[model samples]
Target: MTITSQDQKVRGKNSYTFDEFLEKRSSLDWYKNDPILQKALKKYAGAKYEQIHNELQHFSSAVSSRWNPLAERAARPEARPSMLHFDAFNHRIDRVVRPMETHQLEKEVFGAGLFSSKMPAWESFAKRMLIHQLGEAGVACPLTCTIGLIALLEQYPNEDIPELEQILQHTKEGLEGDFAIGAQFMTEIQGGSDLPANVLEAVPDGKYYRLFGNKFFCSVAHADYSVVTAKISGTDKVSTFIVPSWLSGDKDKEKRNGYEINRIKWKMGTAELPTGEFQYNGALAYPVGPAGKGVAIAAGIVLTLSRLEIGIACAGFMLRAAREASLYGNFRTVFGKKVKDYPLSVRTLKKIEDAAHRTTAGAFKIYHQFLFLDQPLNAGIPVDQPIELRKQLFNLRELVLLQKICATNEGAEVLRDAISVFAGHGVMEEFSSLPRIFRDIVVNEQWEGPRNLLLTQIYRDIQRVTDWYPSADFVANVLEGASQETIDRFAEQLTDLLQRPVCGEVSEASMEAAEEWDVFCDSFFKAYQKIALEELQ
Candidate 1:
C-alpha cells in the first residue's frame, strides 16, 4: 500500500452526539436514571414525590427537544436585548427590549413556577435544577433573583407599601395569566462585596424613596421589578429595597420608574441574558427591611439563595454534560473499536461519571437540609433546643459555599474533558451543546461570588464560632449515615485542617497562607463529598 498525504488525511473522524438520529424515547430520562435525586426527594417531598418527578422528566424533555434550540438561538449577539433610550416622541422611556425567544421562554418558565413561591420551597428549587440541565442560557440568574425576591417578600411583607400585594400576587401566584420577573442590582464599580461602601443615594419621597446612583452589573435589566441596595441620605449603611420597573398604574406602558438603561454589557457566557450597567435617576424604591439591616438581609437571604441555586445548577450541568459525553463515546468509533472500549476513553468517562455522582449526592443532601430550614423555625426540633438550629445553619452555610465553588469550577473542567473526548468536533458549537455548556459553567464559577470570596466566607464563617465550632459538629452530623470509621476519620481530619492559618495579610508570606487555605478547603470538601455520596446510596 502506498503511504501518501491523502492516505494520512483519512483517519478516524471526530464524533459528536447521535441525538438527532435517535428517537425521542432513546433520550435519557434524567429522573429515572438519577436514583440519588430520587433518594434526596424522598427525604423532603413526602407525598409529592411521584408528581414532582414526573413533572421534572417532562420538563427535561421539553428543554432537550423544544426550548433548547430557541434558547441557544437567543444566545447569539444579535438576538440579545438592546435599549430603546427614547420613544418616537423623544420621551425617556429607558426600555430594555429582549427578543421574542427570551419573552416566550420567560412566559413558559414563570408560569411553571420557577420563581413562584406558591409551591413548597424544596419542590420549586427542584424544578429550577431540572431546567438548569439546559444550561443557564441567560435564564438561571433571573430565575434565582426572582426566587430571592419572593423570599424577601415572604420574610418581610410590608403592608404600608400598597403595591406589595399585587407584585407578590403576580410574581408568586402568577395571577390572572400575568407573571412578573425579578432581578437583583447590587454590584457597583466602587463596591463589589462591600455593601457598606455603596454610594447610591435613596432619599424620602412621600411614601417611596427616590434612588440616584449607578449599578455596574444589572442582570436581567428588563425584569419587571428589582431588588436593589442603596444608602439612605442620612447614613452610609446599605438597605434593601424593592424597586419597580414602572410607577404604580403604569402597567404595560412605556414609562420607566425614573431610571436609565445605559447599555447591555457584553459577556462571555449566558448570552441569552441581558445584563447591563444602568443608572437610577430618582427611581422609586420601597424599603424591604430596616435601614441598617441591609447588609445582613442581603447576605443572609438574597445572596444565600442565589449561591444555593448555584450549587444545584452546577450539579445539573455536570450530569447533563457527562450524559452527552458518555452517550456519544459509547457509540463512537476510533480506529477499529468503539471509543468506549478504549482504555483511556473509558478511564476518562468513568472519572466524569464519578464527578457527576459526587456533585449530585452533595447537592441533594444540602438541599434536604435546606428544605427543613424553610419550614417553621426549629422545624422537627423543640424550640428550647436552639443548638440544633445553630448546627443546621452552620452545616448548610459551609455546604452551600463549598459546593458552589468546587462544583462550578469542576463542572467546567468536566465539560472541558468531555469535549476532549470529541476531539475536533468538541469546539464546534453546531456539533453539540458542550461548547455552550462549557461557557455557561465558566460564568457560573464567578456569578454569585467568585472562588476566593466563597473560600474566605467558608473559612471566616467556620472561624467565627466561639463556645463551639458548630461547623465541626455540622460536618460530623451530615456524615452520620456513613460508617463510624469513616465519620471518625473525617472528624480528626477536619479538626486538623480547621487549625490551619486563615488568609489575612497580602504579602508573599500571606500568599503562602492563602494557598494553604485553598488547598485545605479543596481536600476537605472532597472528603465530605465522599461521605455525602455514600449517604445518598
Candidate 2:
C-alpha cells in the first residue's frame, strides 16, 4: 500500500492516501452485515472476506496489464492526444467489450459460487457486472444487446445449451475491446420504436442476410459489429442480425462494409460516447433469434434487463456522488466549523445515506427475485398464473419495476443534493465528479424504457387484479397494523386506478394516471415496511 512517486503524482489533491485506497478496496465492510448479499456474493462471486483482497489484487492486475502496455506506447507527447479521439476511444472500448472480461467475470464470480448456491451463476454475474460497469455510460446500446441475448436464450426451452454457450462466447469475443456499439434502428424518419416500422430490408443469401437501409441514432459507431434489427424479405417479421465492420464484396476496401457514418449526435449528457446515423447497401448480417418476434423478444429480454441495470447503476452513481459530498462536508469549513457540523448539512447527508440504503436494498430484493425466476423450477412456465409460482413471479416482476423506478428517480434527487452540498466546487469538473455524475443520472433515466413507460407497465400489473385487489392478502400481511388508516387510503387509490381502463394503451391521460398510480404504490410499499417491522417485532 506504499505510495510510490508515480502513485503520489496520480493521487495529487485526493483526500485518501494510497494505503486508505488499498484498505477500502480490500474491505467488504460496506457489504459485510447484509447476510443475504454475503450469501449471494459468495455463492456467485467466489469471494469470501478471506480471499477478497487477493481477488481484488487479481482484478487490478488484469486491468493494469492491458492498460499499461498501451500507456507505455503512447507516452510520447506527440503520440498522445489532448482528447481521446474517436478511433482510439473505439479501440479501447472494443478491447473491454469482449467475453474474456465480461463473461469470464460472470463464470468466475456468480457461476463459480464465490458466495452462495445458485444456478446459472454466469448469467447472474454478467447481469450484475453489466450494471456495475455500464450504468455510468447511460445509453450503452451494446450492454443492452448483450443482456437481451441472455434473456432470449432463457426463452428457448429446447435450445442446445452448448450452442447457446457458443453464441455467447462468440458475442463476447466480438464485443470485447469495444465500449459502445452503434444503434441503427431509431430515426427521425421512422415514427415508432418498432423495428418492423423500419424501412431497412435484408436480402437472404444462404445463412447470411444482406442489409440495405439507413438508420439514425446509432450509439456506438466504432463498434466492430452492428446488431441491426431489420425486416427480412417474404414476411413482415422483424429480425436482428449481426453485421461486421469488414465484409466480402465491398467497393471501398478500407471502408469494408458499404455503410457510411453520417454524423455524431450532440446530446444533453454522456457526450463522451458517440451516437451517429448511417446508410449502407449490402452490409452482411447473421440472424439473431427467430424472425418476426424481435420486438417481443427485445422487450422481454433486452429492455427489461437494461431497465434493471439502469436502476442498479443509478444507485452506484448516487453512492459515489454522495460519498464525495459527505467527505467534502466533513473537511470544508464554513462559519468557523466544518459544514457537516451544521444540522442542515447533517440532515442532507443522512437523507442521501437513507436513500442509498433503500436503493441498494430494493435492488437486492429484485436480484433475489431474478434468481428465483431463473431457477429450474420456474423454467418453461409463463411468469404469471399457476398459484404459488404465479405469486412469486408476479412479485418478482413488480419489485424489479418498482426498484427501477425508485432507484432512478431517487438517485437523480440524491445527485442534485450532492452537487448542492459541494456548492461552487461541485459544478466544476476539476473539483468534483458531480457534473459527470449528474449526466450519468440523466442517462439512467432515459435508458431502458423511460419513467412514464415503466410507470404505465406497473399500473397495468395493479389493474390485473380488477375484481379483488391483486396480492391483497400479501399486501395486508405486509401492511398489518399500519394504522389501518394508511392502508385503507392506499387501497382506495389502487381501487380507483384499477377501475379505470389504463393498461395496454399509451395516452397522455393514461400516463398521468400511471404516475398517480406509482405514487399510490410507493405509499403501499411504505405500509408493507410497517408490516415487515411488526413481524420482526
Per-candidate TM vs. native? 0.90, 0.70
> CA lDDT of 305 in candidate 1?
80
Please give the lDDT score at residue 469 for candidate 2. Answer: 36
Q: Rate the local accuracy (lDDT) of all candidates.
A: 0.77, 0.54
Per-candidate clashes, comma-separated: 0, 30
Per-residue CA lDDT of candidate 2, range 164-275, in tens? 4344444443324322222334332473444447777889877677888888766655554555677888778777666666644332334456566666666655544456
Q: Which stretches of candidate 1 lie over 4 Å from their true place?
A: 1-29, 32-36, 39-44, 115-122, 375-385, 470-474, 482-499, 507-509
For every candidate, C-alpha RMSD to the true structure in Å: 4.3, 8.8
> Candidate 1 overall Cα lDDT vs. reference?
0.77
Candidate maximizing TM-score: 1
Task: Judge candidate 2 at residue 54 and give its lDDT.
Answer: 37
Q: For candidate 2, which ten residues in a row score worst on lDDT?
A: 91-100
Best by lDDT: 1
